[model samples]
Target: MATTPSSAMRSLDRAFDVLGVLEDTRQPLRLSEVARRAELHVATAQRILNVLIERGYAAKEETGYVAGPAAVATAHAFLVNNRLSQVALPVLQELAATTSLTASLYVRVGHFRVLIARVQGRNPLRYQLPIGEKLPLYLGAGKALAAWLPDAELHSLIEQSAPFTRVSGEHVTAEDLAADLDQVRKAGYALSLSERAVNVTAVSAPIRHAEDVLGALSIAGPSSELTETDHTRLIGEVCRAADAIAARCP
Candidate 1:
């Protein structure tokens, strides 16, 4: 049977709705939760999720459905191959060289931030984040990008990424994470003091494209080297690099 245009449109809309819900949640969501958030029937949600899973856009887990690697790859292809990285890399390198701290580019993919590139400083004590590592959107430079998102979207993300626990074994509560995000918004930057890695300190600022905040640029180093004064200076440098990248983005 020939597919009707109206029916096809409806299916497309539901598929995108499912994707949007998954993007906001950032973690695997149960089928029931997905249906509730997408405002679709359970059967309809299952059908759409099955299609997404088949196409490698979503993965079915014990808890629920989560974004798959293909989804992240598509996002990375757009950002890494685009002109933003080209424009940002040199500036990031300069920042690292000047501050003797590691500089990196982090872009949000789904509910996580992926480090797409890094420029290492001469300082042997600096922390190193390998390219392609995914970090929670509530931490470090991830929080900077998350804070710049629309308020509703940011709130949704926080709710979805709740029970925030540090990968490094430090305990971080959702309320504390929200408070930190508030500071990031007011200060126009983000800071992490051994939140992700012990003895590492980081400061980050968002990179904007037109009206959309695309990603963040951050500098990291040993906590001992990044004293209060150095942290402030790093924030300034990161923001300047972000501005330079935004101006040259294509």
Candidate 2:
């Protein structure tokens, strides 16, 4: 006797849900976290995680578990095949080649953003987004992505993280971030000096296909390499690349 299609589908869905929780945080998450996020009992989630770990879809770390190497490969395959990445990767490649900086494309997923495609700078010291990584709404490259979000959504995100974010030099409060978002809206780009990491800096622009905000295009490198002048110049280049990519989006 063979398993029914519905039973297989149910198993598949649970597996995907387990995988999604790991992907969303992009950090090693505890078993409780995965269970809570997946809306499954701890024992059920643990069983799924064990299977995922056995198959390399998830890994166990000191803190918890993260998406594993096989999951990374799947994300790379998606980047190679996705319409968004297909349209945007060339632009990112050229930008990285010309600027000697890391170029990245991020698309909104649920309430967060996922890195779908990226081109790396050759420099030994450079920023990296190695696929299947998710980003918060109020951080570096995320700032440009966040600018276009609706008022209610944006407010919710800010209110959630504004406390820890206030530790940084740039955003001291939700109001400060709101003001920065306003600037991102006006200037058509966003820049972060030390928002995420102390020495990594980035400039980013929005990717819009028609009326919908599709994603963001960003160039990142060491803080020293991206000077004020360099940062200003990259803003225009990033925005231009974004428009070109958006035009080709299917």
Instruction: Supply every candidate's count of residue pairs whose N, Cα or C atoms clash at under 3 angstroms.
Output: 0, 0
TM-score of each: 0.69, 0.77
Over the stretch 1-250, how does candidate 1's per-residue lDDT look in tens digits? Answer: 9899999999999999998788767578999999999999999999999999999999998888998778878877876676767788889889989988888898888678988878888884434555767788887789889987787888888888777677567666678767878888888888888777778888899997788887899888888766798777777888988898888877
State residue 182's C-alpha deviation in candidate 2, in Å. Answer: 1.9
Task: Say which candidate scores most in TM-score.
Answer: 2
For model 1, the superposed segments whose C-alpha errors exceed 4 Å read: 1-80, 124-128, 167-170
| Residue 239, candidate 2: alpha-carbon lDDT | 88
**What is the Cα-based TM-score of model 1?**
0.69
Give me the runs in candidate 2 sitting further than 4 Å from their true place: 1-17, 24-40, 44-77, 122-124, 166-171
C-alpha lDDT of all candidate models, in order: 0.83, 0.82
Please give the lDDT score for candidate 2. Answer: 0.82
